[model samples]
Target: MKYFFFMLAAAPLSVCCQTLVHAQVISKSTQQAIPFATVGLVKQNNGTTTDEIGSFKIQCRSIEDSIIISAVGFKTARVAVSVVLSARKIELEENLVLLEEVSISWRNKAKPTTLNDFVHCPTNYYSVGLGTYRQVAQRFLAPRASMRLQSIRLCKMAGKATFRVRVYAMDSITGMPSTDLLSKELLINSSDKNVYIDLQENIVLPDRDFFIAVEWLFISSNEFRVKAKIDRQKISYSNYAPRLSFKKLTGIPTQNNCRMLNFNGSWQKPENYDSNHVFMIAAELGSQ
Candidate 1:
């Protein structure tokens, strides 16, 4: 039997997309670092998060490309890559926007398929891998209207895992996830093996198709807050990149198989993956 190793990687070419830069996002008036900030390249899908203390390094195509920084309670920040690189630190003002009304159907009928891969995670490396990042986006359809995303259900490997989840409408041409539904994305701190996290967003949905995206914030380092899990019995994965278990499908997928990727910096999608991950990621939706 042929074995497949699940990992995402990018080329080592010395191109504009390979240029790396670092920045620290903090409160402008208070001079305090903002933790869990979403920093990324504008006009592109490539992005990453700041550590608990508000520090991060990102790969950019060039100093000409724009960089965007956004946090839960602060106003979004956008600046030129050259300007941010020159400044080394960014300060965003806080915005106290109220959470929207939440509506989630707690019925088991609304529960998504529970898939599991029983794979173990490596405990050494900080993030998912040395030069890679892991993302799981599953294709799903909203059955009813008056839906607001309430929570995401998943199984944690061991200790606490901090990740960011985003809901997107699928693209029309490529069939991938479209733009981030909300210009701003929320951060999540998951800490249990199998539990539902109350996602604090009041997003209304229609009876249409969508995708649930999960980005693992596994940075490999003792200097920052560690969110890595461990397991001895299952197949061990590298610490450099996150290894979320997948729910193996016995039959072929009707639409897109749960999208899996191991990317090194730039945005690259897998060509032909027929299997779904045991990420067991589910969302709670309720009507208004």
Candidate 2:
């Protein structure tokens, strides 16, 4: 993605027949209005930039289209167009820290005994790889409470191949895994090789822990599968951690059958981690 620095100016009058919504995008920390922020209708691709006051008016063809607001040095925001038209004004809180450059090292060259052993509570572990594509999955549990899976980090394995990555989420209690709560397909190319897919869910679980899974495919071909799973364990005061596992399944490994290389471990959330919060660090692979 290209990043540009610009200031927004005054708002223009609404055009006829189009539905208009007013919005203001601001930096969460500086509290200063961000101008020239990109605000557009996701479905229709019609958008406008914020003025110097960090305010912009977007005109959409219909209420079904969603309004996506984005700015440099800020996290992207999306909301239903109908809601914005009804409310007249929407405010977005931006995340100051974007992705930082880091290095990755691979280890534990052995295969996994069982996939079940890969399941652990969610902590703060991050993984990266590349091939034809990528995928990620996570499970959060709070039997009586509800939570949201906010952001995820993904990148290509250097010197390897680049591929498309897809993500999916489901309820662990359901007998059939085909019932997906959400699914998004992504294109990872040379220009935008490393991508971060953020998930926002408002669903409430029957309890604290749930399952999340992500699968990466070779574009439209499912010749190989690279998957990740995280089991989230609830502690106290809304604090939780993840047990992380990374696996790679290749068609040629088991005579064209899928074979997995698994890494098993757990991660700990720092005392001050929040939903929009992110911590950057490096990873070193260890031999089994």
Candidate 3:
């Protein structure tokens, strides 16, 4: 659904009394903390992330919103808002098959540039919500027939966060992302400099160009701002109005291929932004 963003402090009239729940998510088998888990209102496209210790405070908009907690390799736990608000700790069973780690080296004829090669410096940044996304075109020519996307990197500017990574096949008409290459969500934790989300899937690159998108599952807090030459051109990373500033340039087709599902419920380039300030994120590829 198309919707406008609102400030964190602003509440809708439907809010009579909100449910404030403090909870922690951890792995059931290992008893370890599961940080950056997606916890929030189900079907409402609203949520928050657990901190480093797996602790989070969920503010339910209303009792009608079902609360669900999910992670990359864990089973999703869904419960009523009231049921969650009263619980202390929730444990999620692992959905992964744990085997001894093995390393394999594959011989390739050509080695392409690293992920750092495609990424540019960030001119702006934005927070993500349900359906909110930042997209970058994948135009790299790889020698391999198929490769594994091991991890994705996001430059963390603020709070601990998590999002789903999606790789879509290019549309024949608009050259935009048309078909989903993935069946499940690839959850990413943005708290670590070394943090990367494992794709757990194969990227078949046979004259295949695509779009990589980061769709927000949950963002914890808003902590920064950006000001421009004019007062009306101010920019900030806030909920309901999360935005990325365009890098200033004279004229070019654009080395930076980026766009946003902006607050106005439209997919357009950033207003007054020169260079597409998609983000400063990296992706690492592994052997097929």
Top candidate on lDDT is 1
Clash counts per candidate, in order, are: 21, 39, 4
Residue pairs in collision within model 3: 5-240, 6-240, 246-273, 247-275
Q: Give the poorly placed runs of model 2, Cα more than 4 Å off.
A: 1-16, 96-288
TM for candidate 3 is 0.52
**Per-residue lDDT of 1-288 in model 3, one digit per residue for the tens?**
122233332233126435677878889999999876767565454556677789877555676667677665677787776766677788889876531211222233232434533344343444443333333333333334365555554443434544456666655565555555554555444444333444444455433355566555344343333222336664444452223222334555555455443322224444444353334455455555
TM of each candidate vs. truth: 0.61, 0.28, 0.52
Every candidate's lDDT: 0.56, 0.37, 0.50
Per-candidate RMSD, Å: 7.6, 18.5, 8.2
Which regions of candidate 3 deviate over 4 angstroms? 1-17, 98-110, 113-122, 128-222, 225-288
- Return the top candidate by TM-score: 1
Error in Å for residue 269 of model 1: 4.8
- Residue 59 accuracy (lDDT) in model 2: 56
Ranking by lDDT: 1, 3, 2
Indicate the worst ten consecutive residues by lDDT in candidate 3.
99-108
